[model samples]
Target: MWSGDELDLDAYLARIGRPGGSGAAGELRPDLRTLYAVHRAHTAAITFESLDVLLGRPVALDVKSIEDKLVHGRRGGYCYEQNSLLAAALERIGFEVSGRGARNRTRGDSLLAVTHAVLVVTVEGEPWLCDAGFGYQGPREPVPLGRPGAEVQQGEWTYRVRKEEDGILVLCLLRGGVWRDLYAFSPQRYHPVDYVLLNHYSSTHPGSSFIGRVVVHLPGDGVRRALVGRELTLLHPDGLAERRVVGPDELLAVLDREFALRLPERDAAELVRMYPAGD
Candidate 1:
């Protein structure tokens, strides 16, 4: 596990509301519980998207590089980078987190090998599914693999987990009385290089959705995004809100008011350009 001083530790712990990870205060022991809590908190706070793609960044995989952009630089990233950072923090907080590659489940399931990075956490002799990298349909808690009776619902979304042949873990969402394929994976360990191919495809390929727009994903019971200045839309559990933040200053103001996140001057200009104003 990665051990660090108080600054990173305090920031990470405060994010999970478990100071020093735990002290016999929460529902369960700090070990597994801390992992789940942090997973939820991180996903709730940090979104997974190529905002850096909109900002003209060369999204790198190394935690130090990612930390410089996200932790130190006040920026956000997509799955490969975001999940990697969260995994590092989990390791630092004394959880046994192993990286696992997966695929997007929405739309038609991709034929590609497990090309995206998720995680499997072995907690208390059980493998728990944990991911903070998915922007939309994501697990708000660590899921017990093969536990049919176990389910979770937060806001307007619900999730269910099952184990299949060869111990591969399957996760799906309960949608319209149908099982929606979100993603599936096995507990096999993962490496950083496993995601590099995905990173390359998502970043450079013209057909990849990440390159085509400016995506600002802030997930809660609500989510909002302004896709390349075309329109701004927000999805809440109850309803939806849409608008257009036309110029740089107006976009900054909207960012401040809506998300309470301030953007750097240079980034502000790039945001407006990435999502150029519409007449």
Candidate 2:
């Protein structure tokens, strides 16, 4: 029962580094320009990380807690927290937003569960996809929603919206000339409570990958940086990439300097333990 009343519009804007007023006093519309501005700014400012999950803390999906954690607390989170915060902000910004459940195809092809979340927004009677989550695979700007075979190319990344035989829509990424499925979702609407259940599973279940791994992602000027259990990768748009296994001693500095996170001493020490050297 999110009334969309809990978000602090001013604080949220500051958190995303879009603190300036959008325009004159007129009500803002969900136009393409505004959507791109918000989406890109949100993705750039916030990051995709699993610090709470890694530290064995509960993940909150409510609007108040989300605002407090992501906006006021100045921290990053995974899909549920990230998209939930984005959806709430978009609603307050006057967008026709629908929260949808999805399955991560990267995890497997074995009839995956709805472990991911995304937003389908309508602007001027047309649907567009916007997500601040999805880490390195997230779009830099909102992409038009289309049927199978339709594609949107942002720099080096090529994303396609494909409709499966069962009428499920999947977002695919083209990498190294191969089309890899990112996630699959139906038009089925999802609610905040629904995400609470999904979030609990993702954070607590022993089978969940987020339970023990150190995953951090932040989009840079022209590259996406990701750290997965000490293996740091920098993927550039021009097919250039670099990777190295980072040591535990440098993990905190990387999180602070590279990802722009200011973690508490306890959290920082715990993260170092979570991703120890040679892990």
Per-candidate TM-scores read: 0.79, 0.92
Residue 7 of model 2 has an lDDT of 79
Tell me how candidate 2 scores on lDDT: 0.81
**Whole-model Cα lDDT of every candidate shown, in order:** 0.64, 0.81
The TM-score leader among the candidates is: 2
Clashing pairs in 1: none
Candidate 1 lDDT, 1-279, residue by residue in tens: 222222254444454445544453233334865766677777666655576765556778876676666666656667787777777776655567677877666768456545567877677677677777666556666777647546777666667776678876668876556667778786677777767777888788776767767665565654534334444556443334555545554776766665445668887777767665555
Q: Count the backbone clashes (under 3 Å) in each candidate.
A: 0, 0
In candidate 2, stretches whose alpha carbon ends up further than 4 angstroms from where it belongs are 21-27, 238-241
Model 2 compared with the native: what TM-score?
Answer: 0.92
